[model samples]
Target: MFKQMVIILMTSVLVNNYVLNKFLGICPFLGVSKKLKQAAGMSVAVIFVQVMATAATWPIYTFLLVPNNLKYLETIVFILVIAALVQFVEMALKKFIPSLYKSLGVYLPLITTNCAVLGVCLNNISDGYGFAESLVSALGCGLGFMLAMVLFAGVRGRMESSDVPKAFRGLPITLIAASIVSLSFYGFRGIIDNLFK
Candidate 1:
């Protein structure tokens, strides 16, 4: 069981990253990643939301939805849970850390619709993970998202200083950088299995 949990955690963090590898949440990946501070703030918010969403959704699926023949409503339930969690985070940030709340701006609310958070909850159910495993998976995916955002922010920072051709100046160069970052995550594909071997 321990080994399985470790494998799940590592696989989600590196091999099956929601952002870079799976392409689940690309909007904030590009929008907030312009500055390191914004990226870090958004990443932390996302991590909090993912873990909290999984915590809320897993038991609801297992105890409520599964037994009541309401399995078809998992998508709706999960979204509501995620949106609520995002709102909670937004309020907390606004009250406690107004600077970060303002820095996040519209992207903070965007977490409500972040497919990465939704995907984690849905994938946890589909993968038949136990409660603990689901939480670990969400945490791993959250860290993976943070990693991608920070790295891309660094890349974008460099791009800001570099001299680029007029053709690939803005969105074009950004997409190219994002693609390269996504490809880099493929390097971890077989690593988890090898580590446990």
Candidate 2:
């Protein structure tokens, strides 16, 4: 059990990273990564929604869907849970953390469809992780996403002031940078294997 927990955490945070390994949320990676401030805001929002959605969806899968042999409903249920969770988080942030809401702004809605969130939930289910493990995995995945996005944002900010060829000016350069980061993350595969073993 302890080993499983560690595996979930390590895999989500590094080995199977949503951004670098899974390539789940590249849209936001490229779009909201222009500014470190915005990147931080989006990351926080993702963490909140992802954790909440995982907490909510895990039980629904384990207690409701799995029991009834309705596993086919997993995808739909997960999507609904994530969407509602994102909406609730958005409203709560607007009421209490007005500044955060302002910073997150439109990106809050984007969280609903963010493939990273859905990917985490699906991965958790496929791995046969229990409620607690799933939650931890989701949180780790969210943190990993934030880490990657913030790192990319900082790099891009510097790149904005750097000289580069005209052909590799925008998306091409960004993809190249992402590929480098992805290669770096591959090192974590050893950590994941050791943890699981």
Which ranges of candidate 2 are over 4 A from the true structure? 1-4, 193-197
Q: What is the C-alpha lDDT profile of model 1 across 162-197, one tens digit per residue?
A: 999999999899999999988888888889878996
Worst 10 residues of 2 by lDDT: 188-197
Model 2 per-residue lDDT tens digits across residues 163-197: 99999998999999889888988877788656556
Q: Model 2 clash tally?
A: 0
Score candidate 2 by lDDT: 0.87
Query: What value of lDDT does candidate 1 attain over all alpha carbons?
Result: 0.89
TM-score of each: 0.91, 0.91
Residue 181 error, candidate 2, Å: 1.3
What C-alpha lDDT do the candidate models reach, one value each?
Answer: 0.89, 0.87
Candidate 2 Cα deviation (angstroms), residue 30: 1.1
- Our model 1 lands, by Cα RMSD against the true structure, at 2.0
